[model samples]
Target: MAYLRLFDWYQTNKRDLPFRKTDNPYHIWVSEIMLQQTQVDTMLPFYDRFLTIYPTIQDLARADIDEILKVVQGIGYYRRFRMLHKGAQYVIDHHDGKLPEDYFKILKIPGIGAYTAGAIMSIAFHKPYPATDGNVIRVLSRVKMLEDDFRLDKNKKKLNEMNKELIENSNNPYLYTQSMMELGATVCKVSNPLCDTCPLQEVCLANINNVQQNYPKMSPLKTKKEIQYFTFILEYKEGFLMRKRTEDLLHGFYEFVQIESDSLNGALTQAQDLGLEIQILDELQPIKHVFTHMIWQINLYRGTISNITSPYEIVHDFSQVPIATVVKKQIKQI
Candidate 1:
């Protein structure tokens, strides 16, 4: 692959991330899982805190799910943490509390997919495995001047195979993997790539053709569905009434009383049906929250509730509870 120059560039220019400083596979695995959706800067503090709390995978395995949820409250995508928790337990029971060294064995753990497994294998074990994250894909797609749409499964498989061969034959697997990722994130960006600063400037076909932006062509995305709802944070005796979510993606999280409605009166009617007796105080501003598949046009409100017929918890402090990020956004300032 002739990536020795790329390796040198990475050593000289890579960001000084905490995970990169450690050879611990568990630490690198945690970083990979967190970095799956979050940017490095936003995830740095949480990473440090999480490691402080759970110094070892064994510590995570013994921790409660509620505490784990609280630790990563604002991070979003809580399912990953749940899976990581389960993976820790799995490693304890099957791998003697040690992160598996083999790629396939690591993949057997929950929440670890191909990219994560590859990252752990190469970055931690220094094995020759292709870690084709989004950044890596973009960088390689441009370097090879690939015309195939990377969105398609077959095209992605080809890219993996190509990079797999490159890493297997590279001067150093760990450096090559991180170097490709660093180059994509810093040099060969999705927009306005820095060709002059790129180590692979001479070999990049996208650069040779002067159409770097046109190389990694992606398919159009499906439109996210949008919905409107009215949500209320009803104050009770010295506290606010909220409910713990027991279903779907937000399971094991807390949320305010929300009704899928367009009007305040209609929302109140829905609330009445659910055995909620409330006195309307005032209506605050509305908020809109977007998810991967749907958009929530939430009409936010605050009021006092005299009594509750259904099961609901009275929370004195919202911060003390592991509320969903959407609910946290609408927390009533006391």
Candidate 2:
């Protein structure tokens, strides 16, 4: 009955997202991957541009990683793109370029997990599969009024099983899954839920008791690790020297000459190691960047490099390179 009500509400209330316009599995897969830990509004432009570049799975499988990352650069979370690329290649090689409809087979793909695999199966293939995301988890927890910490593995596993059963029993699995997600995102939000507008308000235990926030119990956030870096825009004749990061955190992304130094003297010492006598033309204001697990305090400096090197790549055109967002912000300060 709740499913029916949610579906009815979704018929007119669903957001007209571009990904919802088609039943193509490839498109849906791309959208699902992009949607992970990313806001819909922020990813829309990037999704459109990404599809324009690699409209087909085959096209994506063949595109260079650099080219793919260039398009996905500003969107952040480069690892997702890398995984998408690997998944596309896997699909092409094994599944004949078509996304497998079988849930197990789809799960075997490099980037896809339980949620993504379920979404593609139900939405694109019209199969009975449940895709439980964070929003869906919240909705289910409140509907059942489960007091268990939803962040715990046992509770999450239980919710996934519950969702699977719900999907299996539903007459319209496709609409059921989508509508549930829509309801959670728009109506049954985590904080200050729109209980009056929610279709499940009457049936939801959390809503009836006015304890929506207390249902989906969350774990405390961990302390953000602090790190300090000295970034330099080593400008040569007409370009800045850039290097590809092979280290952990933002691995494989490009950035200006940088070193992990908290002080100017220490940064200068590291700069000398690179065989460059840098005259500090400008010392920009310090910039702070917060990642999921860490906080970066960056000191930015800009100066023309006295020595040109073969180890560094010269980038004159910013548009042509796929630079990390943190590095771009530092460059903008110069």
lDDT winner: 2
At residue 241, candidate 1 shows an lDDT of 85
lDDT of 2 by residue, 150-265 (tens): 76888888899999999998988899889998988898887889999988989999889988879688888889999999878878878888887887678777888777986889
Candidate 1, 1-334: lDDT as tens digits: 4577898898899999899999988889999999986788888989999999998999999999999999988887889999999999999999999997898999899999988998898999999988988887888888888889988988888899988998988968898889898898889988999999999999988899999988688998899988989888888888888888888768788888888987888888989999897687777777888888889998887889888655588888876778877886787432
- Per-model C-alpha lDDT, please? 0.87, 0.88
Error of 2 at 255 (Å): 0.9
Q: What is the TM-score of candidate 1?
A: 0.97
Worst 10 residues of 1 by lDDT: 325-334
Each candidate's TM vs. the true structure?
A: 0.97, 0.97
